[model samples]
Target: MDTRRPTIADVAKRAGVSKGLVSFVFNDKPGVAAPTRVRILAAAEELGWQPDPVARSLSTQRAAALGLVVRRDPTVLAADPFFPAFMAGVETALTERRQVLVLSLVPDAAAETATYRSLAAHRRVDGVLLTDLRHDDDRFPLLAELGLPAVCVGRPDVAGAFPVVNLDDAAGLRSAVDHLVGLGHRRIAYVGGDVGMLHGRRRRKSFLEALARHGLDPVGVVDTDFSAAAGARAVVELLAGAVLPTALVFASDPMAVAGLAVLQRQGVQVPRDCSVTGFDGMDLGRHLHPALTTVEADPLAWGRAAATVLLRLLDDGRADDLELPSAALVLRSSTAPPPDPPG
Candidate 1:
């Protein structure tokens, strides 16, 4: 009854091959014939043997890992479906290449910056994926100085050295506004997330511009931090106002969902008393009572594309910015004509 983790020597002994050959095969180095490579891999698999990350790093100066430093409260991150879907995509890409993802959740911008510095200083990761691109992002300069290759998830206010994999944030928001306008929602209100982030601002601007295109003025606009609590607070503020808008468009699904809950609590019937719309097209939105109408963008695709780009940058020392398809609005039961249209 021996209980011990198997080692490379065990794999080699099982396969009747030298440990050096096993190393060569595991590292994907050439010179090991195809049959021998397969046989060695089979032995390692049977023995449950894997390379030691520390030894691999020291030997090749490659951590074989990617970094993702998120600046968000722990609760906030868990509440947002976007991060999980996006990380799933990133991990999917990394798993194919036998790489690991090193995630760091920080409380604020300063802490995020320090985490990036620490990762780079220790060579903990080969590269990083930058999410939540902000206005006047200082991380670009720091990452460049640290020589840490990165891929930005969204468009930055100013372009920098790294590549970006961003969708057109304005297109989806504009489409949401247009749908509401077409539904005869003239006195529409908007609930947007942090305008400090570039994507947030882009969405807000798009909503305003779309309303202007229809020659309609927004009844009200509320800003939140894209968290459910912030979204709920914004809804309360909107409800407290003297008059209520016919339709409300939210920047994220969680916000729209929260707003819907608030509307329900206030005895406001959706699409009857007020129409509602959301962004992100989260899966949870689909299961709502009336189902949610939303603008659908592929955050999962963004993660995959970003990871691919970052890995390429690490390997080739350069990668090109990618532009995915603009998010499109999907109509559902959440939106309809205003209850009381002008005669």
Candidate 2:
């Protein structure tokens, strides 16, 4: 028998066992005795008969790869600071197990469905991690139909048996709005995110709920795509109104930064005249002229949790609906009570 590219027969011959016995030992079947299994393994090592992972998976009807599907432009995802941090956490968990992560970005629902179907049908990945969940997302039903093990990154409005991992957005937003109210802000406006997204909807709901709890009326709500330019234009619109809000709660740090610039251009002093608060407590927020008063959500931790959950689903077939860590309100220089009305 050739030393290189040795086959199972070579291992069996070297171990002084039958080929079937060698197969049983390598496959971890109980038919082979402990001593026989050890001998076969030793012989296989000597012959460098490393089993092909793909072939093994096919024989066992299992795949060791995990899939991650993001519903956004791939290039934009790379530029976003939060996603990179989150991905690092996911990689850490997968690295420990020596598993592969297959990531894909689908711009629309049709593309997402096609990609998912291909992965599931071919068993390319053992499970999937779905991000950017929208209200009544089309992916949810499709995942169920495919019987694919999957976990979502946000809470779905409709309850399903699939796994989910999400941040405590409601509590985080409540704390942020309450903090602003405590600062003596009377007229507060909300610069919302894409209302169709689950996280954005939750944040908006929390904002209104907190305002109601504080016995304050909602001043204005501007729904905009999550972009710095959109946030800047929304702020300008608010400023152009006859009655400008004294405080604003932005859905994201980038938006808050953009709003801050617009306010500065109008010669409005932060905290002294108009207060600002941001979510997603990104590092850039801390470096702002007035440090942003924001909620701190650990994206890395979120990623790690999502990866772990997906892996667990694959390994044990134990689907878990997990809630990841929530953000805490961080009081900074960017927020304060509204200035007294001119007499």
- Worst 10-residue lDDT window for candidate 2 reads 73-82
Which candidate has the highest lDDT of all? Answer: 1
Q: Assess the local accuracy of residue 194 in candidate 2 as a C-alpha lDDT between 0 and 100.
A: 83
Model 2, 131-209: lDDT tens digits are: 7778777887898899888888777787866788988877878888888888788789999888888888888989999
lDDT of 1 by residue, 1-343 (tens): 6699898889999989998888878777778888998899899898888899777657566888999998888998999878999999999999999999999999987898899999999999999998888888889889989988888898888958878888887888888888888877788899999888887888899999999999988888988888878888888898888878889999999999989999999998998989999989899888997799999987898888899998898776788889999888988899888998548
Which 10 consecutive positions of candidate 1 have the poorest summed lDDT?
Answer: 53-62
What lDDT does candidate 2 reach at residue 49?
89
Clashes of each: 0, 0
Against the unseen true structure, what C-alpha lDDT does each candidate score?
Answer: 0.88, 0.84
In candidate 2, stretches whose alpha carbon ends up further than 4 angstroms from where it belongs are 1-53, 74-79
**136 in model 2: Cα distance from truth in Å?**
1.8
